[model samples]
Target: MAAILSGDRLRFLLGRFKDRLWVKPLVVCLLSIVAAFIAKLVDGTTLAQHVPEIAAESVETLLSIMAGSMLVIATFSVASMVSAYASAASTATPRSFTLVVGDDASQNALSTFVGAFIFSVVALVAVKNNYFEAAGLFILFVLTVCVFGMVIFTFVRWVDRIARLGRMGSTIEKVEKAATAALKRRRNAPTLRGVKLTSEPHGRTVVATSVGYVQHIDIAAIQAWAEENDVRVIVAALPGTFAAPGRALAYISNLSREQGLEQKQEDFDDTRVVRSFHIGPDRLFDDDPRFGLVVLSEIAGRALSPAVNDPGTAIGVIGTLLRLLVLWGEPAVEQDEQAPSYDRVEVPEISVRDMFDDAFTAIARDGAGMVEVAVRLQKALHALALVGDPALRAAAEYHGRLALKRAKAALAMEEDYTAVRDVAMFSETGSQRNY
Candidate 1:
């Protein structure tokens, strides 16, 4: 359990750090300062004399030019990134801003610019103070040339990426990728490596202490606690659940009832159990597969609005949702069928109906009047119904009927309504009717 908790915690912390804009740049800046001092190691050695005599004026001129140009470039990069973030929020959904901001290419470009600028400034200071011998100056010059080449390479790549970074297609692709990964993770571990909670357990309720979304649940920690206390824990609120002061986070039942009064409800540490659930102001995409689906639907909804009127994007999102949903219906690999790692912890599986609702409900409602969108949506749902999973087929059929009904009402032309109805053809028992 300790090993499990350590790996989980490490992954969580690394994910959090990767999302921050400053962490990479700060580390690069520190490395830049260190690199400036490292060249001084050969200051007093005979190697200093044997090395080529590079003029101090030439080095100074190069460093001065880099310092001035790099600062301006860094400022421009920051402005461009800010614009990209704003465009993603306005064009797509604001919830997608995190994924856009965490883009590796943008962050790496920014870090390189800042790091180069710092290196130039430090090198300039060292030159003016006469801190380096001949060897040190030569090494510094070589490092400066390498830095210049890296900057050029990074800037060119960043230019290409920034051009399409916040555009509709790019945004949809990003959201789809995130949603796909989350869906795959949840599909593999439906109960989070714990026993499935079939029904409500009779136990003492453990309520949350704060108001926020449940971002991460440390099942390993909870399992360890349950094992130590000889209790069985039923997780009431999964990730993405909105938690509040009075909301139940989990339930704890004494497993050692035969051992008598020593293991009673009063002895339970509610605080420890509550602490295992990390609450935050907003839901995260890492642990909450539903959040990603919700964001994708939001983008489609906005595109279908009168102000945007981009049905192509909505159609594209439907295709993306289809790919993600297919993953949900895939059978788990043999490794996943082994015994549960956290036997004492029981967690409820994600609802298939809820997943379909999050992925398609808004798009179905918003795009009902458009014949192109309506036809595409019905086709997508019809395709999902063909997947082998019974639960998936049922949910897909339910949503298909609902979307068909919505289109029939919103679309004025009888021909347009007929078009949607022809594609849907939903029937009970996962069978399709001939049009």
Candidate 2:
């Protein structure tokens, strides 16, 4: 069990659980109940005598106030969060709803309100039933005061966060942050700490059992299975790939063929191999960096739509994409100069061209007629072409030329066409030309 739930797999599961709305509130509620009972332990302690007695009426009044106000506040918070989720889905892309919903400030505030409400109700019930002595009552009073302070602090912070929670700029920023983190992880571990799959895999194919997007691959688990079975596993599908029952998830080749252990390949559990590839109805941003880029592009496309006609937002998204792409192009620091951690597992690297396509293809097509967006995009692409990474330069140049072609066809005015073409000259000649 420990081996199966270790490393990235554990982190992935925890990350998913953390995003749930009920998880934090449930934990906080449990803690609140525990705190209510813990004060009872001070009933026979000498420390209770040292603490001044808190008036029963005063404590009761405070708990009653908290119980009433916190319940109202929690309800208001839920309504506000639901509104924000709807706004994020409507204004931005629906794909970004998860990021908006999983906001830490919003979740923490809701948890605090719910927890405070539970604490007050529980304390009120205990007080009415004569469950606490003078010493226990004093402790409970102090805990109640602390809970009040926490509620106030959380409410203030949450107010500030909720103001901009569902705005387009905030949504885009959240997507960019997610994209940056995923890109950084991929950059550091290009093959996911596995041997690079440079050539076509030649072995027994392991097909997926489900049909959905590949959300994560447990490289450590696959490596363990490979070691135990004396075989080399080549992962065919990376995160974000669509998995189907007929699609090959991996290829297993017998490593001990010289020892006449080839027969063992027939006994390989394909179920175990399929389990390492997590399939979900939708792609996740945690392991699939391209999903972030795609979502960002979707937001830009929506902004550039005929009904929206918000070219400025599209231009802003281009800048955000540039920042992420530049981060991806940066030199990665190697943690170990030796062999990869999962030597028995081989996986393919994410293609830079695909990243560029995911990041800019839709924006270019949607904003083609808008000269402002077109010019800014060409300049952004030009900037990327000079980033010094050959793959980055090539992808940027290819996209730049493609966007220029789109602009030329869409722009009827000669001046608008000329303006975009001059900026795009950098992609063709490696330097911008003065018109």
TM-scores of the candidates in the order shown: 0.95, 0.96
Candidate 1 residue pairs in clash (backbone atoms < 3 Å):
none
lDDT tens digits by residue: candidate 1, 230-307: 899999999999999989999998877845645568887878889999999999999899999999999999999999
- On TM-score, the leading prediction is 2
Residue 424 lDDT (model 1): 79
Worst 10-residue lDDT window, candidate 1: 426-435
lDDT by residue for model 2 (222-337), tens: 98888888889999999999999889999998888856654667788877788989999999999999999999999999999999989999999999999999999999985868
Over 4 Å off, model 2:
258-261, 426-430, 433-435
Candidate 2 matches the true fold with a TM-score of: 0.96
Report the number of clashing residue pairs per model.
0, 0
How well does candidate 1 score on lDDT at residue 391? 92
Q: Which regions of candidate 1 fall more than 4 Å away from where they truly are?
A: 1-5, 258-262, 427-435
Q: What are the lDDT scores of the predictions, listed in order?
A: 0.89, 0.91
